[model samples]
Target: MDLATRATPLATTTVHRAGRLRTGGAELSWHADRTTTPVVFVHGSFDDHTSWDGVVPLLPPGVTAVRYDRRGHSGSSAPGRTVIHEHVGDLVSVITELSGGSAHVVGHSYGALVSLMAAVRHPELVRSVLVHEPPAFPLLTGDPVGEPMRDAARAHVITVAEHIEAGRTEDAVALFAEKVAFGERWRELFDGPQRAMLAANARTFLDQFRDPDHYALDLAALAAGPVPITLTVGTDGPPAVRRITEILAERLPAATVHTITGAGHAPHLSHPAEFAAALARHLDRTHLDRTRPA
Candidate 1:
């Protein structure tokens, strides 16, 4: 059932459960709403499983949305080290344990990168992928058109790093919000709980950012993979992010792009209904494609 046609409120209808998974030497906190089709959600840096609260409840009835706090964030164990490959392993483990080995994946920002890498590394375990702007900046290295964007990102990184090193995590989070996530009107966009969440996970963001290979992707491997990918971009998102998504669509043969009008980085937070509807469509399309004859 679509969001509008559904009579019962998700609060009353969805069954929520809490669970744990051990991966990459960290005990990860996971949540699931028991249903027919598993749809795992991967949240970006400086965020946690609660990031999907707005969207998951609104998803169609059959989707069992599973979301977990990544290592070093929220309830997960913080090992003081964050690596992209470990995150990919964590995602695969999550899928294996919670989703019956294969499931549709949806991710935002850094989580998007993890989900894409997981799809490439374990195509047999991924049904399909829906990702918002992944900060795969390495893809822009040699492109002349991306030089300016790269420069701007580097500057933002420097400033954010300075704040983090100075032990001003709140300041770093605010700077990130103003510059990348929410733009000029960030103060109005982020609420107290959301801001607290970002502030709390600030150090993890720095840890991930410092990893040299965190933003790298093997485009050739992803292109050759069988898993279908959907790259989602918000109309009001950062220009660099939009460019990265554009480059990804150009490179990945089995990938498609979708835009959410007037939304920014966290569309699931800012535009839950639209995001949920888009996910529902993706779920339907993947099911149809898999069931269709060759």
Candidate 2:
């Protein structure tokens, strides 16, 4: 119940490069502490490390949490091309370099998809992955609503892309806020504070949505790969996010799917306490599982 203790300030570290990879050089910003195993935070599309502002304070003691402005966003270097594999490779480099080999990876939205790819491609560099609403449709093949959700996601991406190309980032962002971020009922929920946060990070969001390969990756294949994974969806999240979470839970081996009550897509931001508590519990359980007698 002591939220104060969970609100420890995470010290920011300077940006560092993780050797040369396919996308030239990938850089990351890290926060290290003396006690905890490093937990790398990956931001979703249209956002940067700042997206983790709320949840950072809630992370457990000794945990080294790192967030990077995935290539082309914020302070990180952008190498022109915006392919998904390149982004995945950037993640691989960051994790391997920062965690000293492996890390507990947490990703939201598009970042979740990248995290899955990194885990699968370089399993040795990932201990466990906490994927929050990865938009992988094919994995939910059996679900009646799966196809529709995928179609919607695709359509949304295309619409946003066109808007961005036409130099209408504001319009694209507004439309996204209406249909995706705050759906019908919750539109009113994003009053003063939430709107401020969204507005501040609007540019990054626009850039992410406009990227060419944002929706081109094979999310299902990435999810099916061998990795200890945790899937989380907010109870009040959009139907598409919930659907994606369900599909991931069903497809991933050794995966646990959870719905955080009274939260939305950005639970880490909207409900920091609940988000931190759930993450802490998951990390504890994961540690126990790893040390348990086989």
Top lDDT hit: 1
- Tell me the TM-score of model 1: 0.92
Task: For each candidate in the order shown, give its overall lDDT on alpha carbons.
Answer: 0.84, 0.67
- Tens-digit lDDT track of model 2 for 1-294: 122224445433223222322335544444433234667888876567766767766766646666777776655666454667777887877677666777888998888888887887787888888878876555545568877776776687668767767767666666676676556554454555545544444555555555555544444655666667888898887787788777666656568877899787878767877877777778877783453234
Q: lDDT of candidate 2?
A: 0.67
* Native-structure RMSD, model 1: 3.4
**Pairs that clash in candidate 1:** none
Clashes of 2: 3
Off by over 4 Å in 1: 1-14, 288-294
What digit string (tens of lDDT, one per residue) describes model 1 on residues 1-294? Answer: 222212146432556778889987899999888756788899998889988878876777666788999998989986767888888899999999988998899999999999999988899999999999998887778888876887788788778878887889898998888786668877665689888888888888888878888887888998998888888899998888888888998998678788999998889988989998888788777884443234
